[model samples]
Target: MEKPLLVTDFLDRARRYYGDREAIVATTGDRYTYDEFGARADGFAAALADRGIEKGDRVAVLDPNTHYHLEAAYGIMQLGAVHTPLNYRLVPDDFEYILEDAGVDAIYADYEHAEKIEAVRDEVPTETFVTNDTDAVDGDWESFDELVDTDETFERPKMDENDVITINYTSGTTGDPKGVCRTHRTETLHAYIVSLHQEIRDDDVYLWTLPMFHVNGWGHIFAVTGMGATHVCTRGVDAGGIFEAIRTEDVTYLCGAPTVLNMLVDYYERHDVATTGDRDVRIATAGSAPPEAVIRAVEDDFGWYLKHVYGATETGPLITTSDARRFFEDGSDARFAVKKRQGLGYLGTEVRVVDEDGTDVPEDDATLGEVVVRGNQVMDRYWNKPEATEEAFTDRIEGYYHTGDLATVDENGMIAIRDRKKDIIISGGENISSIELEDTLYEHDAVADVAVIPAPSSEWGETPKAFVVPTSGDPDEPGTDVDELVSFTRAHLATYKAVSKVEFVESLPTTATGKVQKYELRQREWDEEDRMIGEG
Candidate 1:
């Protein structure tokens, strides 16, 4: 049977087929079934309609991973309004820019983040402010819990498959954030593609560790619910809490960034953990390509299968998968090496590595070029910005969306990421991938987090310097020292990728979505230069 291509159809099917099944367990000890979830969503939809929320209007949500956030997503989508998920960690100015840019009609913000929106709400086009936290009500703002208590039910609005459903703002390293507008068709197809690669099943219990505001949590909301799987809402990404949730809730699947994986490995090592539950859990990691050591630990130490994926917010977030390959008949070690490359494109996606003129790069496993993609899952356009949207799809060889990421295609057609066009560090007429040095430095025992950028060198034109966060603050800790870290890297990776200088910090700068702001780190080194090192 064919269902509507919209997300509301997915939610309705889950409620009809799995109404008795648990859909969410909040950190505050609240639980909801598919029926209850749908009812809450419907109630909020009615409430929004009362406040003049019409189809095609923009409703922005700023909150952490919670049941409230999920309900807001369904409610907005049900009304045929485009849901713009905001990163709550953004500063007041960033929030101001996005709300004004999208021309949002209403904003649903968590209690902790309400003030940031309130500070500039008057300047934005928004007419309503719905507070998610019970304690965050002002004279003009409405309470989220009050909306849930309403008994009104609104009919789901009629929607075309290609209608815009969501707009996600990406944190590009060197420019202002661009809103990636995705249609119902694009989002649904991406869920199917990601589910195939992730092996999502009906019995899977998924823990929402990844931020739901990030590419709609990589489109898992539709994928998991469509499979009749259970979701456990997590308030924070604490390792202890995640471990307990997996053990108690029988969680089977989850996804996060490489930084999240790093946190898990660090916690597991320091605490000497055994098992989260009797069964092994599967985790999908992206945001940054993980090192081989992190992959090994997830398999050997944690007994979890870590799947690596690569994508940006513009690609509906599912471009490729790095799973087991057929040509690795040699052994597991060699096989793991191949799996590290971002694998072939998903079902409806076409990926190519192309040179400067958009010519295909040879698959000799050495020739590096920018990755260009074209797919049904690609974003429709940047919201309200035709120039940026045109630029994003420009210079297309047969209508491909040019990804700014640089990579190398292997003989087996697996894509190994080399660097971003903006992130390459050139030193003494030699080009280096900052990712290479950061990956090498991640192996250091003391480095909890690391970002490599080009530093001004008196001899070499530019050299790699690492800004690192030690696992333990004390440098005198048994295994924590800068010299030891440098020595470890020198032994592991090539000499060029070794960290030239290390600065111990409490933490590296990060965006609202948790990606390390390496451009900011690079700016500290390149302010006086006549030219930036990498773009040439």
Candidate 2:
């Protein structure tokens, strides 16, 4: 009994078993059951086939977290077409570059994001422009509603499990974003891992706080749908809107980056809002660990359990979860400490902290090494980039993907990230973790959001500089002085790891997924330097 593992299998199951179940709650105030949703996806697939879209055509989807995006994803994949989701936060030039790079043959964009694609429509190879906007329709663009208004059916192509199903682009921190190619088998296995780690149940209600474009919403679209969970879609991530959705939709589970959690915490404290309601919500956050203080606040003050997971786009976007429920039963400080570390690898995932020579690092919890992983869910390659693909899997140990993140493993097998290999600062021949310094600063009352980067220095080769967003103060004059903050870091961390300088800013630059772009900060600091030097 061997069967091809396809993402459309989840949709098929939902349509068969939970036909009348409420499947989607759109931000546009529309609701659809699984039956209706399946029909819409089918109609979209049929429309594409009618328009001469071949099975292998590359279809791009540009939208926020909307129902249309979900339908478009299923429809594109239904015809065995490659789905390419564009980051909506990117500029028009970035869009043009990606469309050209991916060789997008067709596009389905929302009204809000259509302008970015329309600006470069004539230059790219795309022949079809499908806009989901009902009110505004140009002569060159086709209306999404009209396209999916058909009752005709399309035949499903014979799909291979190893066929590339989606191509997700990286945030392009250093240069142009690289397309991470994922196959049906890879995503299907990743969704199974997500279900196992998150403990997804059929009664669960998932809120779309994370963008659908990011790693296929961290594979929740398939996992939750397969479990027959109701989806509550939000157009964008807003603190107040998230709270409203949880209260109104009875949301049981959600995922977001640490920045989103920080926003929610700030909104709750400022508005005097209560976190407890009729439902008990569990949140999964990644893209940099949440500050220990924030984690404590989320559990103690907000009455929500925060699970810190870790991974990147190239690694199926999920590798480990910090569910310490088995080891720490009581709600003690030790429990929170355990929950803060990214726990063991998910079931069937093999994770190791390896040195440059591919030797496993000691579990002393202090020896830093790059995190490497091998699993069924790991991506097969980078789209159209053979060199990048070769480099990703060219680890000393064959069949493992290098994650480019520096982390340490404790005796208990709990993994904690120290810093990105590039972001680690080497001052006086000592490695300083920017993440560690930033985490220490987060404990200070005056500091709100912070990013630590290596600043060029003739005295020590390089030094750690903190760019801080104060909770309340003038950007020019932060409430906490630089000397005091430096002293505070010295008090908590090693003296060598103390911040050498501080800059007060209104905000730190971030990717679309809310990850602080440390490379941008490093570029600014080392603009005049000949060689970028660091050790981690």
The lDDT leader among the candidates is: 2
User: Each candidate's lDDT (Cα)?
Assistant: 0.79, 0.83
* lDDT per residue as tens, model 2, 1-536: 99889998999998999999999998889999999898889989998988877777899999888889889999999999999998786657778889999999999999887887888888898988999874564447888878888988899999999999999997654345789999999999999989988989988989998889888889997999898899998888789988888888888999876667777877988996756558788999874456567777788888888787878788898999888687786567787667767778988899999998999999999988888899888998988889878878885566799887778899889888765665456554344667778888999999999998888664455688999999885677678889999999887755767898999999999999999988788778777753344211
Q: Clashes per prediction?
A: 0, 0
Q: What's each prediction's TM-score?
A: 0.79, 0.81
Model 2 poorest 10 in a row by lDDT:
527-536
- Angstrom error at residue 1, model 2: 2.1
Count: clashes, candidate 1: 0
- Show model 2 residue runs off by greater than 4 Å: 137-139, 423-536
